[model samples]
Target: MMPNRRRENAIIGLGVIALAQVRSRKRKNFWIKNCLLNHDEECPMPLLPELQENNPDDFRNYLHMTDACFHQLFALLSPYIKKRDTCMRTAIPAEQRLIATLRYLATGRSLQDLKSTTGISPQALGLIIPETCSAIIQVLQKDYIPFPSNPQQWQDVAAQFQHQWDFPNCGGAIAGKHIRIVPPPNSGSDYLNYKGFCSIVMLAVVSATYEFLFLDVGKNGCNSDGGAIMQTEFYKRLQNGSLNLPPAEENVEGLNFVFVADEAFALGENILKPFPMRNLTPEQRIYNYRLSRARRVVENAFGIFSSRFRLFLTPINLAVYKLNHVVLCCCILHNFLLRNSSSYLASVSTDEDPAVSGPAEEAASRPSVGVMTGLEPGHAELPSQDAHDIQQKYLEYFVGKGAVPWQEIVADYLI
Candidate 1:
């Protein structure tokens, strides 16, 4: 009798466990299939197939990439983002996962809003977007968004800057952009910035044609542009001579290719910032204008970046680390599209904003207005005499050899 009673109890416990799982599945299915997200006749969201067949333009608008570019990206990311089915639930299709993730990055819609359209729950998107963003950077970083590590590559970048922007031996222009985010839980004031909001910084070095040669993110917003850049590994590499920059110009023995920067950054042997705005001669004014012209590429890169990926305009509501991944992924995608998509630049002409935010939506952007020449440059550390000497050399170059037709006219207007 005892043996029989024990056998019955075991069977009863198994039955109870099975019942609980059944109820759990029911609840899960309800979240997946109920309302506008349902995969049924009454559903309103755009299906990938339907978009592919009917409205290719809408497909591009929705994903921020041409279908060809999408397929290329999807091909690379399939192995990373693909999911396997389980007994409890069928895995969301890999295509759908990519679609949902791209839409989030492209549109910067709230996860709740995305849920209604993608048939993905906000909970799922909160998980999927960052992971997909990581996959994007992992798959694309080496090729599309690489920083110049060798002297040859660095020289090539400098050559492009000289050829395109007429700034000789200029490897790149540096700019800092503030990206706002909801502060992490119990973080105290650690993430709070001078802007009276919590944010992170994206310090990038952009090529003359507006490609991102190097991007350093994850700095707290409290740090000034100089501080943020000083803390970067790039700065360490630059200071230590491990950056593998091309040989110095024939005219100057130790002067290498220079990066044009604004007042927010310090002048250095290889980094040129404009003369102080207070008092200036014609030579000084010309130098400022020339530096500003080269530096404007960084501003254009950031503006067009914000314009393309409206996500940069909206406050990203994710953890700091995940937000870093998102920023990295965007930089990668920006380069990828530049290389692959013919329509990418053409889309800039579109007046249509992909994501329209309510006024209540606190905007976080690169602040295109006052960036190229910041209004009031922060007083970081004073520069060494060597740095000043470099700036003087560039001033002479701008006035003598590198002078443009209208630079004198433009410089005089400023005075």
Candidate 2:
């Protein structure tokens, strides 16, 4: 009986060995089929020629190149970001995340698609996008993007305005644009209006070179530009004399010599507006025309931003917080490009021709009068007498200064 038991045990052991060998062989076969072999083993996969590949779609192309652009942008932004605990822990290594977000914004690609193409996990991608945008905005608002700091810079900018667009002593052009955003998760359909759906207001300031200097975001889509401005820290600074501004005598065009907005903004002592009244005198018409020519810089800047970051042109389906980051990131990239001349600015034309293919055409098409949509209706309606009074003030100011006639400058550029 003992000999019989031993023989049975040996037989069982042999059967187990046979089963293990079979499983090992199956695993090897699987690896071979999937081409997972090391260099010692030949891979039997076929190689395809590069030219034979199909042209990449816009999304793919954006993902491919944005990887590089974001890297450089983040490197410039890293030091300031590292200071914050939240930024340090969760920050999307600036280059990778920022580029990815820009690619998404520029192309309006799905987050899943971006994850697949960029190899960034969807969850990480989501977190990185907003964090990077916030970081970029902080960097731009703090260090890189300047807001007419000294009298010299303001004078230089004003000179550019006079020389390039024909308006003299203009500090910058200011305008407001509504960036379309997804309604809050629980909001009713009535909240979404004729502009499709939107959430934030972009109140931007553009330099004479058409560079975006200040981009303030996150105001409710329901709010007016004036409301947004009133609520901003920058506006508060302006109100409190924290922002060092040139004196009233140096005021160019009108309102303390600061070229602010056209009819969209309310006319004030510090902010310039076009001929406010319907019947304009010859001098007021010239000032209005010249101011229109100069103020187009901000309009062109917005146009360029929207056109290049096509995401702004479309409805953003991200969370409200994420949408704010997206807007800021786009603005940072816009300024970075303007400063470095390697980004979108290189492709833009500086020629005075209104027929240019990019932002110039968009700027030309925007209305010269009336309030921009997404504002409170009564907020923009200026009193006619006040408008006339403002116009008279500007005419008196311009004539007193003996500045070159605005029409000559406009004619030079238009011709």
Candidate 3:
């Protein structure tokens, strides 16, 4: 009986090996190229030349960039993304690649859906869009979205803050925006935030004109606003004095110009957040008003980003690493459009509520770009005396010389 059983097992093993064997496969052919994609007739333009040349408003809406800006960007990006035509088919045009990528970011349409309109197969699109976005970032990043390192540059940023926001000696406004992503693979609760879904925080420092001065992303969603910023390289730079903050001129109340945030950030030598919401005197109320008002620039910048690049409004289907590339590309384009004088870009308004937090990051609403108001403090760490003095100096300035005419009225309204 044992001998018979061993023979049966040997036979079964031999059968299993036979079933697992794979023969040399036939050379595969294009499933959806010239036959399905009528590139010469239908999608050669991405949008037709007529639409771009004739209907300017609709073109900008469709692509989220003006035609001139689009042409300029293509000139820079085409070298990086340009491809050669194979014997089988002509290459997807460089202009189409740029247009398709911009539309993908602006509309958040799936590649399958994009296929019908762009006449590019979903397979080709999957390759084209990410690569083109990477090209956009690489070509434009150094010039369009550079971080300031010189003392004169920092002072210029501070001067902008003082001139526009009535916040003296303010270098910039800082905030954290949780960019929603599909749950990272094997990242058990790692990318999950207090709000219950997976995301990566975009910690941005914005100038007064709603441009990103510096931005760091990929903070685990589980961290709070303060926690996220604290974990960034910017925080390390701030600690080590490599951030190249200008020396306190006679203008800044004997302190370095500061970046303003809401309650979720720590007070530091060059960072300020609003006072506690509860039990605030009129002076403190004024301080909160001034801080929140100045911090709105960062929020508005995020709002404009989300508004123009509709991808942020949706849960991006790409992996974590790829999504970072896409986000940076969109951010660079944001700066590009603002700096590009070809056409006027209107920003979408924000509907921010510090009281409402959770899952709002993925809202599909276009006009009302959701933001974490940062009113809810997630940190209890004590600030140093230097930080406190910086806060006091700003408070005195806001009520004294730097006060906006309407601040008291707004502060009174808040009370």
Candidate 4:
């Protein structure tokens, strides 16, 4: 009986050893599979946290905004983009999503590059950016870029133009910028511009403070500025006297108030363009200079905008409508920064092109014909009898009673 019991014990021991060996083999196989599938044992920590914690300058450089700005943005976006947790997996934090989107806008980095810097998968970003852009436009448009609803609001804008730019009765500066983008599937040269690239036009009316009062976007690259303006609802309303612009003020005796533009835009009662072709009169030249001075606000505004949001410098790889949303999102953010931050202008000069941020340096540069307002050529026609008379009246003022002290000095220099 003792011999039989000893033999049973030995068999039980061997069974236990075999079970242990099997479990060890399974553990080894699991690790090996994971190592093959993923290069590291766990995903690396995101780049933003480390920079934000240790190196602040790099953080601001990477995001193109201060930490306070980031917090402000996160607060604004949280209500719309915040995610709910579930049993199976945790949702990404709203802060993480905003950082990812801003990183894209600030750098215009490609998806693969962003994945490396941001640690967000390209697949996730593809969904996040467009949605975030849509949310920005949806949330910020009303308060940030609301059109002038009353005569007082319009007068307020004109007053700023007079105070800052020395131009009277000017509601806003109107211009356009080409937002480059890849061609959509099955699209022809409809997006091609004279510069030989695919683009969409962003025509905006800028206030004296460089805030965009109104925006018209999504026109094809081939659409001239004149055509784009003609197609807008703003144009229709202004033409029909429904835009609530202030009653024509006498900035100069009988001349009416108007928005200034380059010769690219068709002249109208509310729109003021410079005299076409070179003329012999000192007054016309002075009028052009003053008009150009006011108009440079839009150019500088675009320069600062493009410099602040580097996305405009790069061709966007989105559908046409998605591209429009992204541009609108950037414009709103620009205005938000202007409204909230006092140091933005000073800071932008250090980073952006001085031409846009430096209004003083722009004094010497005359408004040349066919300048870069994203307007196509061959669209402007001779001003109507009324439009020509308005231009004449303003010309008389610039060289006459309402003239600036330096108008003739600068006009003579130009001559």
Model 2 weakest 10-residue run by lDDT:
43-52
The total of clashing pairs for model 2 equals 6
Q: What's the CA RMSD for each of the models? A: 8.1, 11.5, 6.1, 11.4
Residue-level lDDT of model 4, residues 1-415, one tens digit each, is 9999999999999999999998777444342333222322233435567777898778788888877777787777799998897974456667777888998998888987886655566777888999998888888889889679888888788888877777888889988877888889888998888889988888999998889999988988888778778888888988898988766643436468799988779988789987765655777788887887788778777877887888887788988877888888998988988887665676332211223534344444433332233667546676689988888888877777777666665555555
> What would you estimate as the lDDT of candidate 1?
0.77
Q: Judge candidate 2 against the unseen true structure and give its global Cα lDDT, from 0 to 1.
A: 0.61
Lowest lDDT 10-residue stretch of candidate 1: 358-367
How well is each residue in 1-415 modelled by candidate 1, as lDDT tens digits?
9999999999999999999998777444354455544433333344666886788898888887888998998999999999998986667667778888888888889999987777777888898888899899888899987688887888788777766656778889997888878888898887777767777888999987678989988987777888888899888888898988887744233355788888888888888998888878888988887787678778878777777788877788988888999999988998898899887766332211112431112112222383222222467787899888878878888888777666676566544
Residues 1-415 of candidate 3: C-alpha lDDT, one tens digit per residue: 9999999999999987876674344546865656445675866454557878899877877887777888888888888988999986688878788888888999989899898778888888989988998888878899988688878888888788777666777778887878778886788999877777778878888998878888887777777878877788888998899988887874467666678887778888888988877888888889887777677778778777777788887777887788888888888889988888434344343333222421232132222336432322476589999899888887887788767666666677655
TM-score of 1: 0.83
- Using TM-score as the yardstick, the better of models 3 and 4 is 3
Model 4: residue 123 alpha-carbon error in angstroms: 1.4
lDDT per model vs. reference: 0.77, 0.61, 0.76, 0.77
Segments in model 3 whose C-alpha atoms lie over 4 Å from true places: 1-37, 44-47, 341-376
